[model samples]
Target: MCTYLKNMANYKHSHLKNKSFEEIQMLFNNTLKWIESFVPMDTELVKGSEKVAKGCSKRATYKLEQEDAKRQRIEEENESVE
Candidate 1:
C-alpha cells in the first residue's frame, strides 16, 4: 500500500512539471502578441518621455544661467564700492 501511494505521488509530480512548462510557453506567446499589438503606442510613450526629460533639463540650465548672472552683477557692484 505504501509503495502504491509513493508511485502515485511521483506520477502527480511528473504531471505537474510537464503542465508548468506548457503554461510558461503559453504565457510567453501571449505576452509577445500583446506587445506586438501595442508597439506603436509604446514607441510614442517612450518618445514623449524623452521630450519631457529634455524640456526639464533645458529649464534647469536656464535657471542656473540666471543665477550665475545675478552673482556676477553682485560681484561687480561690490568691486566698484571698493
Candidate 2:
C-alpha cells in the first residue's frame, strides 16, 4: 500500500508539473484518499478500474487549478511567486 501510494504521488507530481508545488502535493494526497473511498476494497490490482482512477486525478487537478486562476497567469508570464 505504501509503495502504491508513493508511486501515485510521484506520478501526480510529474504529471502536474505545471501546477505549483503545494497544489500538486495537496492534489496527490487527495487522489490517494479518493482511491480509497471510490475504489473497491476487495483487490489491490487496479485492473479495469481506469475510469475511477482517472476521474479522481482529474477532479483533484481541476479543484486546485480552478482556485488559482492567477497562478496560471503568473506561470505563463514566467514570474516566480504568486
Candidate 3:
C-alpha cells in the first residue's frame, strides 16, 4: 500500500493535470477512503502513542545534553592547560 502511494507520488503534476475529471475525482475520493480505513481514528490511542514518543524525545534530549556537557568539560580542561 505504501509502495503504491510512493509510486503514485512519482506521477508528475502535469500527468495528473492531464487526467480526466472522473479519474481525478476517483483519486481524490480514494484518498479520503484510504484515510478513513487506514487511520486508527481513536483519540485516546493517538494521545497515548504521542506520549510515548514524547518520552523518547525527552530521553534523547537529556542524553545529548549530557554528551555536550562532557565535551565542554573536556574542552575547558584542555584550555586550562594552555
- Which candidate's lDDT is highest? 3
Q: lDDT per residue, candidate 2, 25-81, as tens digits?
A: 677678778877785645656664776889999999998888698778778788654
Per-residue alpha-carbon lDDT of candidate 1 for residues 1-46, written as tens digits (9 for 90 to 100): 2233225323344433545656645645655576566646458787
Whole-model lDDT, model 1:
0.66
Please, what are the lDDT tens digits per residue for candidate 3 over residues 1-82? 3334336545456657667878766776686587666646477878898989999999999999999999999999999999
In model 1, which runs have C-alpha deviations exceeding 4 angstroms?
1-42
RMSD of each: 12.3, 20.1, 7.7
Please, what's the RMSD in Å of model 1? 12.3
lDDT of 1 at 75: 100
**Candidate lDDT (C-alpha), each:** 0.66, 0.68, 0.73
Score every model by TM-score: 0.49, 0.29, 0.56
Clashing residue pairs, backbone N/CA/C < 3 A, model 3: none
Candidate 1: count of backbone clashes, pairs at least 3 residues apart or interchain: 0
RMSD of 3: 7.7
Of the candidates shown, which would achieve the greatest TM-score relative to the real structure?
A: 3
